[model samples]
Target: MVSKVNSQTKPRSRFRSRNKLSIKEIFMWLIIIVLFVGMLKVTTLLAKTYQENQHPDSEVYGVWQEKDVAPYAAEQLIFTQDGVVFEGGVIDTNFYFDGKYLEYQHGDTLRRFKFLNKDLTEMKMLLSSGYQPVFQMSEKFQNNIR
Candidate 1:
């Protein structure tokens, strides 16, 4: 009868060890999960901030012309709130702006420009030919167009 009792106790102990979790273990797992969630939240917030910084501001809307040129000879850049008009053509979508630069997406093409002034009155178009054409804001659009 003693041997039978020992064998039954051994099986019960093994079952409890295999099936039950200690409080300390549960607490550790909970901490890990919380840390993971916190990390995810931080990552998401960082991503959102980065995305927000990529868009241009309302100050960029204006009529820009090539700097130091005659009025008739100056090339024009007309920027609306949504897009830009260049070379008599309009690109009405896919615009991105960081604090100092603007990016435009054309069909299979990407154009970049760098701002030269704090007021965003001057900018330079970045081109592959090592030609950075300077443009200066000639006219600004108000919130109301009359």
Candidate 2:
């Protein structure tokens, strides 16, 4: 009976044989982290923009002049930050507008105005009675409306 012993030895590399992370793996992880941070920043900016857009009181602050005034209606309106709205240039009308709509009492009817389009420089509104008007921002409206 002849017993055969295996004498094969594994070759050793010149460098250390450790489970080291490759350069490519490190770069990939770094890129992922950077992208995650970038997305977070973008999300924060978008949220701020949305909140600003929803604040009608802030955007509507200051005075607005009617482009084409009717003989029976006021020609100018001034909206202060304290929810006080003053209309003049003929007959004075005092009212206020919430975030969604503007409400006022005219004789027996309660009038409401809804905004259709709005920006820093211009705003368009639709009245409950199907009247639409575009009000340009007054020169006194110097806040950052964006």
Quick one: best TM-score, which candidate?
1
TM-score of each: 0.59, 0.37
* Superposition TM-score, candidate 2 onto the true structure: 0.37
Report the number of clashing residue pairs per model: 0, 0
Candidate 1 lDDT over 1-146, as tens digits, reads 99999988898888878897889999999999999999999999998688666643566777888987787888897777657787878865546777688888766778788999888889998998966789988888765131
Q: What is the C-alpha lDDT of each candidate?
A: 0.79, 0.56
Q: Which residue pairs collide in model 1, if any?
A: none
All candidates: CA RMSD in angstroms?
6.8, 12.2
Q: Per-residue CA lDDT of candidate 2, range 1-146, in tens?
A: 12322222222332345457789999999999999999999999997677557664465666665556574673455555434344533222544454556555555655455554544444455555565676655655536232
Positional deviation of residue 66's Cα in model 2 after best superposition, in angstroms: 1.5
What lDDT does candidate 1 reach at residue 114?
A: 95
**TM-score of decoy 1:** 0.59
